[model samples]
Every structure is written in C-alpha cells, then in structure tokens.
Target: MKILVVDDDPGIRELVRITLQDAGYAVAAAAEAIGALSMLEAENPDLAIVDVMMPGMDGFALTRELKSFKDMPVLLLTAKGALEDKERGFRAGSDDYVVKPFEPKELLFRVEAILRRYGKEEEAPILAGPLEIDRQSYEVTCGSRTLLLPLKEFELLTILASRPNVVFERERLLELVWGLDYEGDGGTLSVHIKRIRGRLEGLTDRVSIVTVRGVGYKMEILP
Candidate 1:
C-alpha cells in the first residue's frame, strides 16, 4: 500500500515513515498543506494519515479536499481528544481518528482494520451527474473539479446517494449518520446538510436534501 503522511512536526512524520516502511508499504511525507496537495496530485496514494492541527490548512481541510479526488482511507492523528475534535474529524470525511501519544502498532492496527473492513474491491466510486464518489477511497469528484467535503457531509452524501430519490427523514439521517446513541446539538444535522449542498452547489438545479413538506428530508437526484 502506498500511503501519504502529512504532519508539521518532523519527528511525527519520521515516526510514521519508519513504521510504515518497516511494515513494507510505500510512503510519502509532506509537512504542509500545499506540499501535501501537490504530492497527492502526483502520487495517488492508497491511504493518507493526516495530523489535525497545522500551520494553515490543517488536517480537516486536507481531508475535505482530498475527498474530491480519491476515497483513500484517512486516519487522523491529533492530540485533541474532545468530542468536538473527533466530530470535526468525522465531519471532515476521515475514516478513523487516533489520539496523540499512541503506540505505532496501534496506529498500524487501526489503519489495517479500516482497510480490511472497507477494502479496495468494494470502493467503486459513485457518480451522480457532476458529483462523483469513490467508495473505496472516499473521494468525491464533480466533473473534473473536486469538492472538499467534511466527514459528516461525506457520510450524508453516501446515505443519500444509496437511495437517490428516497427521502430520509431528518431524524433518520441523525440516527444513521450521527449515530442513534450520539448526543450533540440537534441543529447540527441541518447545518451539516446545508454545508454539503453548498459544496455541491451548481451541480444540480434543486436541493439535494429536499424538505418533505413538514415530514423530514430526502435526497433529490437529477434525472
């Protein structure tokens, strides 16, 4: 597997490189967001491990941008263990999150686990007109241009894409994507959907999340 490791800290970058290389995987390293984006254009790596905090772009932004091109599994490494941080990671479209001061073995295991569970063979990209989704890599492509989508937006897209014309009540989206056991601000769901639509703007004539006339919401695919 070819992996891209992006982090501002040289020590962390080296640690990831050495560990993955020892495990027999091709790895690429980038210290900043611009470098990472450039490397992505050239390498087309199988997976990416991103650090949440950085000088400017940050891991969240990177994950969202990368989602436009490839569904490559991303494992976010961050010291912030707060729920908001984790939620932010998920919202940015990361496959998994790992807190800092973690064992290398643990990180490797989590990466392997995600790859195994949602392996390459199952990741056929989904295309709905201008929007494209790579199930395997979790990348979204719109025409030749790709849009960066936060993790929740990606999940919400996947759910909606699965049914196309099917209407999923707002509560259903909350339960399925956010998790039935998850407890957060209830308004967060609408905000997320709205953001997703904004990213997908101009791709279609109507809203993806259609109001069900006082019922809930449904994904409206262009015919």
Candidate 2:
C-alpha cells in the first residue's frame, strides 16, 4: 500500500518515510499541507499521515479537506495528546491519531489496523458489464472465455474496471499499477493498456478501455 507523509519538520518526515518504507510501503512526503494537497492526485495514496501544526493549513483542516476530496483515510500525527485534541482529530475526520513521541512499531501497527478496517487487505470481485474480474484468482472472464493476463496487466485492468467510466489520470495509474519508485515513462503504461485491450478484444466487445485524450484511461461498459 502507499502512504503520504505530510509534515513541516524535515526530521519527522524523513523518519516516518524511512519507517514506512522499511515496512514495504510506498512512501511519498510533502513538507506542508499545500504540497500534500497537490500530490494527492499523482500520489494516489491509500492513507495520509499528517502533522497537526502546520503553517497555512492545520492538520485538522487538512483532514477535513482530504476526507472531502477522497475516501482515503487519514492518520493525524502531532505532539498534542490531550483528550480534547484526540476528540478534535476524530471530529475532523481522522481515522486515527499518533503522538509525536510514538514508537515506530506502534505507528506501523496503527497503520495496518486502519488499512484492515478500510478493507484494503482484500478486494472483492469486480463486475463490469460482461467482464468479471476475480482479484484473488487474478482472472478475467467474459462469457465462457477466460483471459489470464500478466500480473501488471491484470492489476492495471483491475484498477480501471473497479471504477467504470471514471477517468484515471495517467500519473495516478502509473503509481497505482507500477509503484511509487517506478522510473519508467508513460510509454510503458501505454503499452500495457494496449496489450490489455488486445486480450479483451477476443473475449468480449461489451467492455472496453477508453483513452481520455490527454488525461488517461477509463473502463467503459456498453449496453
């Protein structure tokens, strides 16, 4: 899973980044709230770790904004550990809160707990028109035909098919399907999309991957 760390403290940001990265998570860091907001789309983070005290926008306000913008869960990290501060964090839509002097293991545990609560541990089968994507089996079936796609192809298709007709930004898709550390260009993504389209062509014509011109791609289910 991917996590975004938003903090003004350089030391805190680096520490959290290293901690999460060591736990096998893709980490993205932002120095402040504005930068964090800007990275939201491209980062496509599953969760956000935000500091309470910020210059422009505080963590509580950012939590509200983040919750409003997406269904992503936010974990507020701050020095404040009072009962009222905790209540305020919850009121502001934070999924969880961690005090500044927290142990690295504790933070990881909390992150895992929140993700499990969000159902990120397991995904259900997705049905888009005639296509049925079984995430567990990594199989796509249309009618009587079954298409066994490559790992990357399957993940890419699954991401698009999960939200039919919703345009996925190219950068977002790359980060989701590939990884935060992917050094490749858009050509790789284009090629994968092309391959998926070719494989799906023989299985069914009802489902399609539509290019959104300069934006990215979306899955379309035709009647």
Candidate 3:
C-alpha cells in the first residue's frame, strides 16, 4: 500500500518514513501542504498521514481540500488532544485522529482500523429515492442537504440503511452497533435509534424506522 506522510519536522518525517517503509508500505514524504498536494497528483496514495501543525496550510485545511476531490482517507497525527481539536479534525474530513506522544503500535492500530473501515464500508440505500449515502465519505445526503455524521452515528446509519426492510434484533444491533464487548444494555442502542429517528423526523412518516413489536427495529420502506 502507498501512503503520503506530511510533516514539516524533518526528524518526524524521517522517523515516520523509516517506520512505515519497514512495514512494507511505499512512503512519500512531504514537508508542506503544497508539496503534499503535488505528491498526491503525481502518485495517488491509498491513504495520507498528516500533522496538524505546519507552517502554511495546516493539516486541517489540507484535509478539507482533499475531500473536495473524493472520499480519501486522511489520518491526523498531532499533539492537539482537546475535544475541540479532535472535532475540528473530523470536521476537516479526517478518517482517524491520533494524538502526539503516541505509541508506534497505537499509530499502527489506528491506521489499520481506518483502512479497514473504508475497505468494508457499505453504501447507504437510496431509501425510497430520497436518502443517499457515500460510504467512503460517511456522508448522508437528503435531498439537497448533505449531513456529515460522527463516527459511531455514521456506522450505525450504515448498518441500518444497508439492509432496509430487514428486522435486526436488539441483541444483533447491540453487538453490531455498540460492539461485541459493549456492556450497555439494549437501551444504548435505543438512544442511537432515537437520535437517528430525530434526525429523520421529517421523513419519519415516509422513510421510517419501525420497532419490530417484541423483537428490535427495522428501517421501514414507506409505501
């Protein structure tokens, strides 16, 4: 796999290059956003790892630019750990965020997770021809409005929207939506369902999510 590593710090750039190269990935190193853009044009990489702080056109801005083309996976490697910074990264189109002073193993794991998420990502259904999902971008388009979802919400919507008219049991939803190791009860899934339903309130009468009596929930295809 090919990866573009962008960081202004030469030492950091070399370190990342060596580490990723050793792991059997073709690595392209860039010191600035312009250089990174040039490299992207020259060699369309599978993924990009960018540092948040740079002299000009920081990683956030670069990520915004990258998303304009298509749904490209971008991972942020930065020292900024505040929730705001993390949110900003996501808002800027980052697929994953890793805080600085991180373990190499942790970085490796995050990268793998992001790649896997993109690989297995499912496209959202046309939902009676109103809702559209671009799995790679995690974007839900309703009419002319396009909404960007948080990671968990995105995953949840993907699962339900992928299989319309099918009743997914509560246990199944918990395991799939909340993860296998999640300790929360069925209520957790309900919260997410409520949130999704709230967002689709206007369409609830048409493209609704139905509670399957004693079972769980199914995204009902309106007649």
Candidate 4:
C-alpha cells in the first residue's frame, strides 16, 4: 500500500514516513495540502495521512475536499484527541483519526482496519476504477458487466487490478501467479495478457493494461 503523509512539521513528516515504510508500505510526504494534491495527480496513493494544521488549508478542509472531489480516504493525524475533534474529523470525511503522540503499532492497526473496511486488505477484492476482482467468489466485473475469463487470465487481472498503476515486472508476476515451481516461457505470460486484454476490450473505458516495453505491465485507470 502507498500512503501519502501531509504535515508542515518536518520532524513529523519524516517520522510518519519512516514508520509506514518500516511497516512495509510505500510512502510519500507533503508539507501541505497543495503538494499532496499535486502528488495525487502524478500517482494514485492508496491512502493519505493528513495533518489537521497547515499553513493555507487545515486538515479538515483538505479532508472535505478530498472526500468530495477526489473520493479518496483520508486519515487525520493531529494533536487534538478530544471527542469533539474526532466528531469533526468524521464530519470532514476522515476514514480514520490518529493523535500525534501515538504508538506506532496502534497506528498500524488503525491503518489496517481502514484498508480492510475498504476492500484493500490483503487477499480482499481488488478494486480499481470500474473493475473489481472478488477473490472470494472468483468473479471479475467491469463497469456493469461481469466477465468470464480463463483461470490464468483471471489471476493475471487480479494481480494487476489489486495494485492499480503499480508496474509489475514480468518475472515477478510469473512467480506470483504461476508459481516459482511452474516452468513456463515468457510467451506464456504474453499469451495470457493478450487473452485478458481481448476479454476486457470495450468492457470499460477507464481500465487499460499498459505494457512498459522491456520491463513489465501495469494497469492504468484513466479519469
């Protein structure tokens, strides 16, 4: 998971970044909301950790804007731990709230909870744009339509859709889906991708399986 941390305090920003990174999450830090907004345009981080106090816009306002316009989850991190502060955080559209003087383990737990609730937990339904891959039911849907795909194709799509815009190297995907014990040529992967692409054609306008020549592939969801 990728988390963007927004805080005016350099110490706090570094602290959060290191904490999340140590917990095996990709992280980016922004000093304010505007910088966070710019990062959102460049890459779609899974969630954002926002500070409640900043120079131009407070975290409440930023959370409201992100929830209203961007439809993204925000976790408010601040020193305000009163009951009313949490209420305000909820009203501002924060999915989770954390106080500054918090245990790192507790923060990780809360983050996991929010991610699980949103179907982003490990092995949950992989959602990206208009596509959803339900691992439980082994079903794939794009837009309003459900697609029937071969086992290999479905697995391939699941891997890509689970982490949208994250480039997966060919070897890495092969290891994950086909297993390290399974011996297969690169053509096997190519064929599977082609089949998946064929099934996805015209099914959704937002999803695109992009090939990064000589490297790997990534699923891009265009707005």
Which one wins on lDDT? 2
Clash pairs (backbone) in predicted model 2: none
**How do the residues 1-223 of candidate 1 rate in per-residue lDDT, one tens digit apiece?**
6889999999999978866754446899999878999987789888889999999999999999888767768899989999999999999899999998776667766877877866642335666655678755678876576665777788778767665676667766675566546688658987887787777675555436676765666677665
Candidate number with the higher lDDT (3 or 4)? 4
TM-score of each: 0.53, 0.55, 0.53, 0.54
Local accuracy of candidate 3 as per-residue lDDT tens digits, 47-161: 8899999998999999997777557789999988999999999999999998876555456557768878878322334343477867567777777877787777766676667
Better of 1 and 2 by TM-score: 2
Mind giving the per-residue lDDT tens digits that candidate 2 earns over 79-123?
A: 999999999999999999999777676787799889899987535
Residues 118-145 of candidate 4: C-alpha lDDT, one tens digit per residue: 8776665677787888865778887678
The root-mean-square deviation over C-alpha atoms between each candidate and the true structure, in angstroms, is: 16.0, 10.8, 13.3, 11.2
**Candidate 4 runs further than 4 Å off:** 124-223
After superposing all C-alphas onto the true structure, candidate 4 shows an RMSD in angstroms of 11.2
lDDT of 3 at 207: 68
Cand. 3 TM to true fold: 0.53
After TM-score superposition, the amount by which residue 1's alpha carbon in candidate 2 deviates from its true location, in angstroms, is 1.2
Q: In lDDT terms, how accurate is model 1?
A: 0.77
Where in model 1 is the C-alpha error above 4 Å? 121-223
Off by over 4 Å in 2: 122-223
Candidate 3 off by > 4 Å: 120-223
Best by TM-score: 2
Select the stronger candidate by lDDT from 2 and 3.
2
Clashing pairs in 4: none
